[model samples]
Target: MAQKKIGSVHDLQTILQISQALTAERDLDRLLWLIISACSRLVDADRSSLFIVDQSRDELWTKVAEQTTTIRLPMGSGIAGTVAKEGQTLNIVDAYQDQRFNPIVDHKSGYRTKSVLCMPLINSSGEVVGVIETINKKNGKAFTARDEQLLGALCSHAAIALDNARLLRQDLAHQSLLHELELAHSIQQGLLPQSAPSISGWTFAIYQSPCEQTGGDYHDFIPHAHCQAVDVVVGDVSGHGVSAALLMSTARAFLRALDQDSTRPGQLLEQINHLLVQDMADDRFMTMVVCRLDESGHVRYASAGHEPPIVFRTENGYCDENVETDLLLGMLDGVGYAEYVLPPLNRGDLLVLCTDGVFEAVSPHTGEVWGMERLRELVRKQASVGASALCQKIMESISDYTDHSPQKDDITLLIAEKT
Candidate 1:
């Protein structure tokens, strides 16, 4: 009865250790290793080993701790294998004397086996992935049921924890990247238009967001034509990160300098391209749609291998207007930045521009693109709405299609709606 009471007490202690292991975030690995190592001490053994089932090989592979490396033993080959295959515990007083004992690993690692205690590690599914085997029993003693009970409980929780750690590790890695990305995101936000310009009868808006909180997309609005025309820039850098963001800042500065000339779109681009080609990396380039929207609503724009802005004529039932395509900036020095002239704009005209992310959303199940045509229809049907609402609706559509998958690239939308 005293022994029985001691066993119950030991089991409770094991349960508490499990609870503590589960609750802790930092000490889980130590807890698992400590429990398995303590199995031999608790049972008065020389050393211990743990193994999980490998269904593919139909064998019990050794998972060696650096402090206690185990050798791979085939199923039914050694004392550990027999115990695991039988789903039972074995306490052998003389391992070397037993013909079933495999001497190969001991021969390799230079450890002798005198006594053995091996048990199967079975989960709730009744499938065995591993075995826990101990040796020598320290001072010629043998293992006890108490040791079996303690180690059994430890193994159950350890297996679960190990599986969880593998999965949680991925999440941890992503979160670490996210934290770094937040720093980049802060820098990106600072580069945007801090606030709206003070202009009469003009509505200005800009939006940029990465699929993963940081990417190469950007947008800005600035003074142009001696403060007579407004310079609007929407662009995507060639890649993501602080590097791309730095390039974006450079682009903004160059655009501002070019805006001083009251220049044509193509001319402004040619000049910026000449400067960027010298500064940008071999792979670094920018796709930009720059436009000058004047107080009278006459628009002149240029493209540098970027998606054309959709000029929605509200009076004509949301007709989407597009200009000609051109080469991307930074592709070569002395490139032309010719400007594209727009027709005289009327009241309630909307210009929609964006990066590649919004149009690249694919259905998770069917893998179909959400496409730019659908995006235009959404804007056309909803162009009368303000800038914020239009962007929100388009984002919602993309999310619905992709199930909120990571944004493949940075997304930007700039609205130069003439009221």
Candidate 2:
């Protein structure tokens, strides 16, 4: 049976049904095919094709029409492309008479060309995203103004549906990635030390902050030989985030294992460096400081391309012991490290060790870094306070200096004081 003409009240009902179906579709391919089919029915056209604009390639492409398996044309090359490019609605009475009509499609498909109604599909931003082309009215008449109006309205609904589907997919992918990052953060936190170790004749305080969920900064305390002394280690991996966190964990394990065999800071770092060079990636490395303090306040320390530790004397004020350093760990195998034994600390003396994140923190407004000079002044001011209080004060000072700027790296601080 022949189909009824589309100008009746029944046609309006059919259009409503098509709109509902198009809005409900979440799959892009199905939605596009529905748009082409629905518009063809609404205008009583023999065939229709939907061409999506590929902005990256500057082309128009489609795979949803009969007699066209897949087609791609440069923008403004054919009737459909011209409508997409100009953001216009074209109603042609005779396709063969129009120079814009390409006869190659008719020749390939063995279908005669007659009339066409081509309209641009515009998104909410008023930008053309695609084109809809209807070919050959079923009654052998050219497409009328009424047909153009109906198809244009349906295209409006279709455009909204396509944009919604794209946004929905992007949101889902973003949510999934966030969940995975959070999980990695939890695992990295679990790898860190739970509490500071108790050492005779000394009080220790520590603070760690990562710019992201996971970070590369690490610190640890290992007891030496029947708790006669404690070894403190602070390190910063080359980068931030999960990969850096993994490298930090590896360095931590290697240092701890090497500490079991040696109490000398230089030997321990040298052995750990040998292992890290074999295990770490070529571009990856770590800056680290290791210190061992005995019950008698004797301090032995070594540095591997890390910031020197600061010592605050109760009577002499602040002094940045700019100790000499070796090449950073993981840079080369069999590298030797040098250890410095500082004069035995007196009671009430405070030592501060930190990662670059503290001294190099950038101010939000001024872009100035909280450099070592400011850190020395802060340490001198807080030297008389308890180790825990001093740690908190330094963190507060850093926060004030940066003025809540987003952190750019991982920060780790360790404070050791003679009781």
Candidate 3:
């Protein structure tokens, strides 16, 4: 049980062999076990533990404990934690005499602790990534200064190896997640209306821009062949990215399947709202507007906490009117939606529905928003153009206003013009 002088040639060779073993293993768990094994054998300790830092939780956790059970401790608590926090070495001759020692672990494990030596594992960037704790030296003596030096050398090698392995694991996980998101984005794009609804006397233009691989914005035009009417809907989920994209997909499916009945846009929205409330989380909801246009040029629309569409009327001195707003979807069950009738559009009139991302876009340089007024002005000026040209011109204006800064949210707009 006597500790051998680490300056000996055999001990140096053993250290070299341990370093090789540590470097060979890339799996974090196996590498951790190797580290503890090397520390126990090199220091002639009864048991050893390696605690890795979890910066997100600000805690130290051991995956390869002597008892084969995981242990978590606050960053600055206990002997191991103190060493990790201060980035210093601690050698305690008597565990019971040390104020920093927590006896709860000893009580639970039924292990009598005597001498303790703990040292920080600092990465190349001079940051403490973890700690090495060796408990109860086999000879029943305090860990010597020589033990600290030898263990410190081992920790230096272990830290760099551990950091590299951790980075690789994180990169692999991130790549996997990105691949899944890209696949989901592809699937989500297919869920949207593949082609704009082709109706006589009407021209439709649709556009969507997602800041991330996935977005919360959704739009679709479903035509009723029997009724000779088209249902146009635009909805925005609470947040952007994966969660919102999933919810958007669900809503799209529900809308398609449930719109088979001959209900008005308001009644259909109420039905969709009840279904969304059951599926959405409490913190999440959606803003939506649905409008049905008949061949006779009659347009009846219902809104759910969504922004009003801009109606550019050439007959009214090129002015724009915003439709009445109402409560959003998925916020409350049994909420009724009121349908409003818009004046039948004459030739060259425009109806534009959009999510907030379009007008609320912030200018990167000036920190000013391209507000609703600017959007309304742009629509009025461009209203005389074809439906596709109008949507394109508005998108160009937004790009110029924001100076092409990275988009923060999903942008969507649907323009329907009476030709």
Candidate 4:
């Protein structure tokens, strides 16, 4: 059927009203409903439907005009699909005579169909982005050329409105996600220790940097049942972001709760492993070092698949203590842990506990990792400095070696020196 140039003043006015109304609606579903309803009234049709093109799937999908349910059909499968595929206006006089018309919809709805005005919705880029189909003219006659022209104009406005609504929805979702991440970052920061512990006859310093807003690394200075000692814990969960932060929080709480029962590093770790194994996911685990330091300079510690602590002695220089590691926490239930008592610390000795992040930091310029050997050598050189100064120097060295490469993981360092 050919399009007629003739249109009434009323039809033009109606189209203008629909264009303004469609542009005002930002919600995609509501905008689609308004488009279909207005198009049906403009063409004096009994019903109408709007189908959006999904180029990736090569399909046309539409929500049922009167219901929340949706229906989909392959492109070029029916009258609407044909118009969309060819990017042409379809004015059918006899629906059943057209082989492209599918009667299954009519049979399912129990409504007899005689004429259809299907038009492709082309955007500014000349791409057919969707289709609009008006069904069964009310007068029981073949739809005229005047009806086709009116619907085509209306569909042009509808296409732009649909595209605007989709972009708005995407922007809103992105903003919502950013807000959530910001809130999570704030909470994760709050869980960390605010300041290093003030223990008499000892100096303490700590450095922690997370790769992202939230991370898996955790460190805590827990007071022991015996007022003479303090337990220092440093651990790393398996991953980053909110899940890992949550796991770190849980581990901190568990460790603090067990502090009242026992200060023995190995026993506390064994109990924590049992609790974590009961709830943690099978693929997730944590590596940690738990050390208890008393005022008398005695140090007892345990490791759960964590990095060994380097003890810098005034007389012997740097030595990596042979702390025996058990299975990583959350790996299995009923795992046993061993505790090692180091030779009592003398005056001017430093004990360093750190996560792998400190030693594994990658240098962007040289493409080299700040390996454990460099860390040991640096610790040996800085042994004479105060614990606080030593920690700052180590962090500065890493920063210079990496040449300001973005941190790739969570880096943590805890240094204790007998002054």
TM-score list, all predictions: 0.60, 0.77, 0.92, 0.85
Tens digits of per-residue lDDT, candidate 1, 1-419, equal: 99989878976785676546543644445644654665665566777777756666767765444345656766777787787688877767787888878787788878887877777766656766567777877777666666677667766765565555545776888999888878878877887777767655568676667665656777777776465877677888887767788898888788777767745667778888888998998888999888778888888789999888887887777665585878898888867766788786778787778887778768888988889899889888998886667877888888888888776677777766777
Q: Which candidate would rank higher by TM-score, 2 or 4?
A: 4
What does the lDDT come to for candidate 1? 0.74
> In candidate 3, which residue ranges exceed 4 Å CA deviation?
1-7, 314-320
Q: Residues 290-408, candidate 3: write the lDDT tens digits.
A: 98988777788999989877788888746546558778889999998998998888888888899999989999988989998888888877777878998999999999999988888
Residue-level lDDT of model 4, residues 1-49, one tens digit each, is: 1232244766788899999999999998889889999988998998888
Candidate 4: worst-modelled 10 consecutive residues by lDDT: 1-10
lDDT of 2 by residue, 237-291 (tens): 9999989998998998888778978858999888889889988899999999998
The better-scoring model by lDDT among 3 and 4 is 3
Q: Stretches of candidate 2 above 4 Å error?
A: 1-8, 26-119, 130-150, 225-228, 256-263, 267-284, 332-334
| Model 2 / residue 126 / CA error / Å | 1.0
- lDDT (C-alpha, whole model) for all candidates: 0.74, 0.87, 0.89, 0.87
- The residue pairs in collision within model 3 are 305-327
Q: How many steric clashes between backbone atoms does each model show?
A: 14, 0, 1, 0
Q: Candidate 3, residue 194: CA error in Å?
A: 2.4
Error of 3 at 413 (Å): 1.0
Top lDDT prediction, candidate number = 3
Report the error of model 1 at residue 162, Å.
Answer: 5.9
